[model samples]
Target: MLSICKIYFMLFLYLSINLFIMALYFILLNMEVFIEYNLLSFNSLSMVMIVFIDWMTLFFMSFVLFIAALVTKYSEDYMGLDKSLNRFILLVVLFVLSMMFLIMSPNLISILLGWDGLGLVSYILVIYYQNIKSYNAGMLTALSNRVGDAALLIAIALMMNFESWNFIFYLDFFKNDDMMKIIMFFVILAAMTKSAQIPFSSWLPAAMAAPTPVSSLVHSSTLVTAGVYLLIRFSSAFSPMFMDFLLFISLFTMFMAGLGANFEFDLKKIIALSTLSQLGLMISILSLGNSDLAFFHLLTHALFKALLFMCAGMIIHSLNNCQDIRFMGGLSLYMPITCTLFNICNLSLCGLPFLSGFYSKDLVVEIMSMGYLNLFVYLIFYLSVGLTVCYSFRVVYYTFTGDSNILVLSTLNENSKIMLSSMIGLVFLVVFMGSILSWVMFPFPYFICLSFVMKMMTCFFILMGIFLGYECAKFSLEYSIKAVLFYNFSMFSASMWNMPFLSTFGVNYYPLFLGKIYMKNFDQGWLEYYGGKNLYNSLKMSSSSFQLFSRNHIKIYLLFIILWLMFMVSFLII
Candidate 1:
């Protein structure tokens, strides 16, 4: 029965894949299809739904569906014979549907609908394990995203001032308007939350409590990239102040994530942090007035990052669910295919020349260099790049090259064709997507005239990063000089400047305290007194008065009527 269900689902995904391809054919022919309808209207405002399909929509939809199909197929074997297999498949499919809604919409209302759907579905997926850790992670994920959802709502409300819920129409008209500036503010705030930029970033690593396939889908393409896509759509209307603010935050996020990844010991958390760093890079490029470059990087990164997570999932499964890299070593000896895929993904992450990440990442660096940035910004960008390379190599050394670190050898082998099949599909994209996107998206090559010194710095940083990574891994047996000398600082780096603690305890303290106050002062106190107790007392008093009137009988009623007639006669005489 399960096998039949899986076959049917796979067939459905394949059908969707073919549909997207047909859409891509139209896109290649430069045919854009836009359709809109008014669902209802009230007092000169209409509830509208807009679907805009251009080259970007078709291209992105193709990749998204392709990956979803692979992941769904992969999950069949990866999940084993769980009791909730059907539920898991259902949630994954719903997640994809929500993402498709997000991809197709151009109106603010439609976007919000899709955005909130992503949040709600992701929360459900993250807590699917029903364990304490997953519950906590799900709450964190949902709450963090709720901030963005609220911001989206505010942005939508702000768009009401323009009398149109469709933001696509206002991009050109409101280019320099002050009201649009305010709207962009909320948009940026919303983007920051979704992208996990600084302060809101701690939830991302914590969210690794989810299943590995969910991690692959969430981190790589669907959830996090929503912010980048939103920004790409609104790029033309961003003011210079917005750009500056975004650049600062993005650089900080990139630097922070890189530092965190270097010190992280958990395998999944390390990869999660790396995803955060790439997200930062995408936003930073978008900040530098190059949304095209950011979008390109987003696409390329999705291909490789998805493959990376799939590889990680296989390793963890093979190792009997152990996720510590310290316990994993010499994997190349047992699973050569997995190791090769891992290395390819990691190298692609480092933006190695000619790979998928290289085309976009290299262009971004060069374009940033050409811009007139301050010394601090320039150094942070280059340093972050170097950190990226360092950590990529470090991960490579720890997982694939070292001697066997486990006490007893388990049967670690990649015999599952379903899992390998998904990874193999992505492998081709991880290798060629850079060139493919470049040829199709850009009509002209990015021509930059830079000095030899500036161009050489990128290469120099790569070498330095490699050297530093080699030395760090080479001295694993020896005591770390940095750890010994600066214990406090080392701990800070490991804890990501206490950001996790701050985001968890620090954020919770105030909210929980406020909730208690509300419970005591309002919910338990005034509300009870005024709404419950007072109403009960008032009703009781009225009942008692009625009883007294009834007990008095007909004589009192006649006396009252006579008194009323006498008063009326007295008024007429006056």
Candidate 2:
């Protein structure tokens, strides 16, 4: 009998292959299918279940399932010893199902069903280890995503004006309407939180507390990209002003994540920050009105990022769960296959020539160069690209080329065949998927007209990044304490510009302090004095006065009668 993990692996792989073929068929035939089932109707409003199938949805679903299959297979070996391996597999399958629902749905309600599902399952996955750190990370992940859920719910409510919940049909038609703009604003907000852009970004790195396979799936194609996918679907609806706004936000996010990753020592967190950075790139390009490029990058990114995480998992497993890159060195000497695969994925992430990342990332930069944008935007864009390379190379130097910092007695080797096989399966895609996707997605090449200097700008940045990365990773006694000189600035950048603090303690502090004040002054103080206690005292005093009056009433009545009779007698005598 097949184990639960193996069953899921086969199931997901089969689904992925079929979906890929279906996606190709849809693309070639230029076909889209919309299936709607009416669940209820109330006075012109209908609650219906809708499945909107097109090439984009099918393609995305294929990639998601493919990654899911590999991650599941990889987890079989990585998590082999865990007693609840079956439960873990089940959670993964459920997560994939939710992602499929999200990919296929064009209606707000159905999308929420999948959106909420992803958020919920991700929290469970993040806290899978049952540790304090995992619990905190899970809470941060869930609460941060809840903001997006709220935004999506508001968007759904606003869509009620159109009498149809399907947003695909209305996005283009209502582009100029004020109500539509409000709905799209909420949609953008939803995407930002889901994608971990800027203020909501604290959760992405924190979510690395999850099991590595879950991180592989979540960061790659499902949780984070859901926002980008939603934006792609609504790309046509954004006004020029909104596009510019989104562009700035995403660019800043890209820059911030890149900077953070350079300072990050945790293996999983470095990768998580990289994922966040790529998400920013996707959204930034999408903001520039090139959703196709964004989606293309999204697909290519999913392939290698998933493989990258699997490699990280293998390393961590061999090292007995040590994730700090500072403690790792010269891994290439011991685990040649894993280290080679890791470098390939890392370089691919840097958009090195001919890799899966290059086709999309290079195109994005080229396209952005052609845009009629300001100098600041251009500078930030290029700088962020360089930062990407810097961190990629930095990670490689620390883990693969540097002297081994691990224990002398430690055993490190790539002997897990099941795990390696899964990674090997994805390696081919990391090498060739970008070129294949570029050809299939764009039959005609984009016109390029730039000065030689401008065209060579990307290469220049990459080279500079390489040099800087090496210097950053080089160990020297003289400069060993140099970081302490700028400790404050280093801390600021390393902590994601203090976003986690702001998102958590910074956000919670004032509100909680005010609540405490209210509890003291109102609930316990003035309200207590004037409300229940005061009322009780007033009631008691009134009851005592009434009792005294009642007891003396008869005596007072007798005195009154005697006085009246005396007055009557005196009147008669007079």
Give the runs in model 1 whose Cα sits over 4 Å from its true position.
Answer: 1-27, 40-46, 475-477, 480-482, 540-574
Over the stretch 1-574, how does candidate 1's per-residue lDDT look in tens digits?
4573366457656765776676557757878788978888999877667899887877777777777777888888888677888788788878878888988898888888889888999999999889999999999999998999998888888888898877887788898998899899999888899999988998899889999988998888899999989999898899898999999999999999987787666889889999999999999999999998998899899889999999999999999888988788899999999999999998898888999998988899999999999999999999999988888887788889878787585879999998998899889989997997898778688889899999988888888888877675555435555457555554677677798789776888898999999999988999989998899999999999999889997978899999999999999999
Clashing pairs in 2: none
How does each model score on lDDT?
A: 0.86, 0.91
Q: Point out the worst 10-residue segment of candidate 2 by lDDT.
A: 472-481
lDDT string for model 2 (1-574, tens) is 8988788888888988998899888888899999989899999877788999999998899899989999999999999999999899999988988989999998888899999999999999999999999998998899899999999999999899998888888788999999999999999999999999998999899999999999999989999999999999999999998998999999999999998888778999999999999999999999999999999999999999999999999999998899999889899999999988998998898889999999999999999999898999999999988988888888888888858898988879889999999999999999999999888888788997888999999999999999987876664213646767555565678899999888777997898899999999999999999998999999999999999889999988999999999999999999
Per-prediction count of colliding residue pairs?
0, 0
| lDDT for residue 552 in candidate 1, whole number 0-100 | 90
TM-score between model 2 and native: 0.90
- Candidate 1: worst 10 consecutive residues by lDDT? 474-483
